[model samples]
Target: MRPAAWLTWGALAFFMLNLAALVGAVLVNSFSTRWFGTWWPEGFTAAWYAEAWREYDLFDVLLVTLQVSLAVVVISVLIGVPTAYALARRNFPGKKLLSLLFLLPILMPPMTYGIPLATVLYKFHLAGSTAGVIVANLVPAVPFVVLTMTPFIEQIDTKIEAAARMCGARTSAVFLRVLAPLLVPGILAASILVLVRTVGMFELTFLTAGPDSQTLVVSLFYSVSAAGIRAQQTVDAMAVIYTASMLVLLVIALRFVNPTQLVTRLKDPAQ
Candidate 1:
């Protein structure tokens, strides 16, 4: 291989090795019973997993995570689909500017705007609540759905809709019977992506979440740093659970959506 190509491969391999080693160490530590100045633990045990689950109140955390994630997905999709249809079909003044506005949340880091957004939510007495988390997550998610679905909507021929109208179909009937089926793949892809994003979202969730409204990510953070002297094994076990949950969601998402296609759709919406 060329010198530059060889260097690139070497760097990639080094990065992958470091990542794998870190993950492997965490996995082992989570299952180990004791390890102090040793290469490995003196004994192995599965009890830490159970201890972490109970002590962290992870069942409730997981429940809150699901509730918040599902709410965000439903609300983002409802607001996004019709908005995407309008943007795809209509030509209005300031359309490009409006689209740029939509892109702002996704383009900027959450920390940049999250504090101000959280302040607004708190001002309205919504912060530290489930509704606040959903609203905070939606700031980016709605735009994501719009961007992802617009290309799908545009790729579809409008002539089909015109024909449906000619057949005496009402607008709602045409949308439900004709457009929805064709849009299913796009909708499913967007919803799953949003679901994963919301579940893994840390900044916004951390800023808005309260004791009762904490998601798994927020709960995991607390497990590591909340006051008392806790077992490192327990914290590692929670980390493993969080990683496993995200991996499962991503796997399910990849089963239905091609990442390359999703990327292409976003980059070249005209296509």
Candidate 2:
């Protein structure tokens, strides 16, 4: 085979190998009754999952995780679309500054925003609520959505919008009928990116999420923290389930948006 093909195959093999190893490690720990210094599990069992399902509140945390992630998706799309349009289509005073401002959360450390954001949320009585989580989460998501959607909006022919206006298509109608269909790819890309990020978020949720609103990651952290190595196997089981769920979501999201279009959305504006 050609050198490029050989390299591609080599890289893919390396990745799959690592992925398999990781899966095996988690699986062995999760399914084994005892995992010490041994190279392999002495026996396999479903007790961890059984305990988790029958006794633990993993399902509650999972539900909260779903709620927050979905809220982030909706909030990101609502807020990001207009900002993306403005950034992509117009050149105004402080345009660069405005762009940078939207990006502050993405560039800044979670602690930087989380500290002050928590205080503010407390003042508003939303500190431990879903709305608070959505607001804090938007720090990462809005910028991501804007960044994803900008390129797609730029690629769309502006003259089509202008012509639609000339033909008596109001601004709302143009966006609703003409631009909306073209945005499907970018929207899906942004939604998936936002969903994955929101689901995996730890620090912000760790700090702000109340017991009633704790996400899976935060709950898992507490579970592992409280139980120590004895719980490692169970934690591994939960991680495996979480990873599998995310993988399924990513596959479904991929089916909605092609890699080419997703890449196009992330490309440099001039390209």
RMSDs, each prediction? 1.9, 3.0
Clashing pairs in 1: none
Collision pairs in model 2: none
Model 2: per-residue lDDT, tens digit, 82-165? 999989999899987887777677778898889888998888888787778878888889988998887779889999999999
Name the regions of candidate 2 deviating beyond 4 angstroms. Answer: 1-19, 257-271
Candidate 1 residue-wise lDDT, 8-37, digit = tens: 999999999999999999999999989878
For model 1 the TM-score comes to: 0.95
Task: State each candidate's clash count.
Answer: 0, 0
Index of the highest-lDDT prediction? 1
Q: lDDT values of the candidates?
A: 0.92, 0.83
Candidate 1 error regions (>4 Å): 1-4, 268-271
lDDT of candidate model 1 versus the reference: 0.92
